[model samples]
Target: MRPAYKQILEAVVVTAELTGSELSAHAQEVMVDDLMAYPLDAVLQALTRCRKELKGRLTLAAILDRLDDGRPGADEAWGVVARALGDESETVVWTEEMAAAAAPARELMMLGDKVGARMAFRDAYERIVSDARSERRSVTWRVSPGSDAERRVAAIVRAVELGRLPAAQAQLLLPTQAVAERHLLLTGSVMTEQERRAGREHVKKLLGMLRGGKVQVARTAG
Candidate 1:
């Protein structure tokens, strides 16, 4: 991929890290639309009807875009994300021989202690978890409206501090499926016949939903 595209992907992933869960089903759809650059009405409608900031949806979109980079319509999807995000369009500018050795021309700003950052993340996660609990919805480490993002970020920092996760996940965090795939491939364990068939069927059904217009659009496709 081009450097510009890679930058956009990186930005989306970072943005998702900033946003947490709390997004509705429709909001999640719009968020995906924004990150992948598909249609924008989905996101616009979601933003207009929703009372809150919809940060969760926005973040989720970025996460999915980064995690499922191999999905069909990757570039086209980023286009949509640009329109919905307005000025944030810069975040998704499509590129790929990117930032080489560059000079540190700007002033190096200092940051607070790690304790402060951790505390902030912890608080945010707690709030999201409390909200999810109140809604009576199950929160998973992957898609829950909680501090999963923060935790993942913390994990990366910890890994860097300890020199670990980079070799495995690279700069981007892996989704549940990605982690599983890597594990299976590394272990040299073949998927069982039933498992392989089931996986194929699941993919087929998902594609069918997207193409056949079975997608649960909370609003018009526009």
Candidate 2:
């Protein structure tokens, strides 16, 4: 093990011991070996989260679960793709794994097999994400700008608001229009400031409902 990694793992082991989950020397070695594949920063963060949130024994699996690499699960990935399919003019910002897995799913959709597409997408996405996580690859978000010139800004702005894209990078992607007018260009429809606030609040409520599992996935294809 590298000196830095060894030091961090030793600290982690000591912390685990204090939490009543003592690890044998051999077990510690094995854990270090497994974790060496991930970035040191990710491991450090995972250890911090595990220390605070984990009630049970600290194990490799538990640390791995806490590694927040910003990669979405199969279901969320599929949801993004499904929403994109609803409008050909819709811009999409997605991770590399999502784009790769989307290829076969798009082909399946073109052949009029939405169900098969969803199944294939889920399986391929899960596998891709797993391999990516194992290699400690950071999720790379890419933007696919649609043909609709007017909607591009709105999409990029939404991506920035959702924390999927950096604001500085988004500025480069946006058109020459001033940043002050972004709210006015949210959609084709014109709305007052009050209406915009209401719309934002409504969206927040819907997102909360979705996160709480109150909203079910529609059976129909987008």
Candidate 3:
């Protein structure tokens, strides 16, 4: 880890202690390594949000989980994290050289081309997901928010939310979005098969509600 990251981790550990929480030395190192993947400010913001929102004892894993929750700059800083896509049998891992290919999307976003960025990301992401699915593997990791499929959904969600894309697209993306959100929540945690099935069923309900229409919007009182 970089000296600066170690310094930040130390500061966070001290702050956690002041807040009546304890951060283990090993945990602190792990958090710093994971966080160093993003811009410094984005990592700090995630940590700050965790400190403000979590009650009771603060753990390093909890803070890292908060970062994965699509908090502000976290998603933007997510970039192309699809390091490797593992097969269903777990026998092989397919990796994509994404950073260079995905640079256009990042540039477009930086240039205020929200639509172009979203489109670019979606195109690259969908292509990746298609390959992964064909190999009978879930998108292992590609960025924050979850798998490549989930990231694709998130890209559409961002565009729609920004009014850069039509809400009609929401129906198409919401199902995968639900799956992605659940998959993300389940990461680094243990759960039963029943619970997993229940999660999928819950996400499926969204399909019926979204069918044949753009997402519904509530009107405010005039």
Candidate 4:
């Protein structure tokens, strides 16, 4: 099931259990809408942990508590939920743990600060890469794109190294370009000149964004 749907079902189930009053269909829909702003994986994981470890019972309060626990596994998910819940409840205040784990990137998006958002995401990428190297995990990208996102990421990083693109722009471009690349690779032999030209033009447009500074980067941390 989609995490959002699962969470909605579980929340209602938990509410009914704790209150002994079935939440009306309208109420259930409203709850789903509220929770939908959160990242699905985090919400689903929090719900699972809340049910399993929090006395095999669940409630919105219980789930919120689990999210607020700030334990190792829960911290990131909690950060995600906290950002989504932003100032909606008097009980929910911004916490340092949530900020460290998840807030900067989200806050930037909320403030219409795309440049700041890119910097934050780029920082996360650098941290993960550093961590992977320290742990001796393979950091090399494979030659072909395949299903290897890391390879695409590595290719993007390489572009940064070669001065072909900025790290932020490369990261932003690769995911979209990867889809285009996959399409071309899959259909290249059968593609007509016009089709190939169209694909090339699409790629040119993406690269143009980077060269033309269509996306911005921050000069200092915000």
Best by lDDT: 2
For residues 34-152, could you state the per-residue lDDT of candidate 1 as single tens digits? 43452234333333333244444554323322232222132342332223223321212111200010011111111423344334433443344334333434322111112344444
Per-residue lDDT of candidate 2, residues 1-222 (tens digit): 578677667767865875679798888888888887777787888888887888888887777766767888678889888666656887888899998898889877878888998999998887787778767777888788777866877778787877888776776777543233344434434677787677668667777887666434553332
Best by TM-score: 2
Q: In model 4, how large is the Cα lDDT of residue 92?
A: 22
Candidate number that wins on lDDT, 1 or 2 = 2
TM-score of each: 0.20, 0.58, 0.31, 0.26
Model 1 ranges off by over 4 Å: 1-110, 141-222
Comparing 2 with 3 on TM-score, the higher-scoring candidate is 2
- Candidate 3 per-residue lDDT, tens place, 1-222, comes to 667697668657865775688667777677677556655765576578766777777765555544432221213422332221211211111123243335557667667676677677656655544443334342222222234554456554554544444455344445453554434333524456786678778767766676623434333322
Please state the error at residue 75 of candidate 3 in Å: 16
Worst 10 residues of 1 by lDDT: 97-106
- Candidates sorted on lDDT, descending: 2, 3, 4, 1
lDDT of 4 by residue, 111-185 (tens): 877566656744654354334333434323212222445455555555455444444455454665554444433
Between candidates 3 and 4, the TM-score winner: 3
**Residue 27's lDDT in candidate 2:** 87
Candidate 3 wrongly placed segments (more than 4 Å): 1-3, 68-222
Clash counts for all predictions: 19, 0, 1, 0
Mind sharing the TM-score for model 3? Answer: 0.31
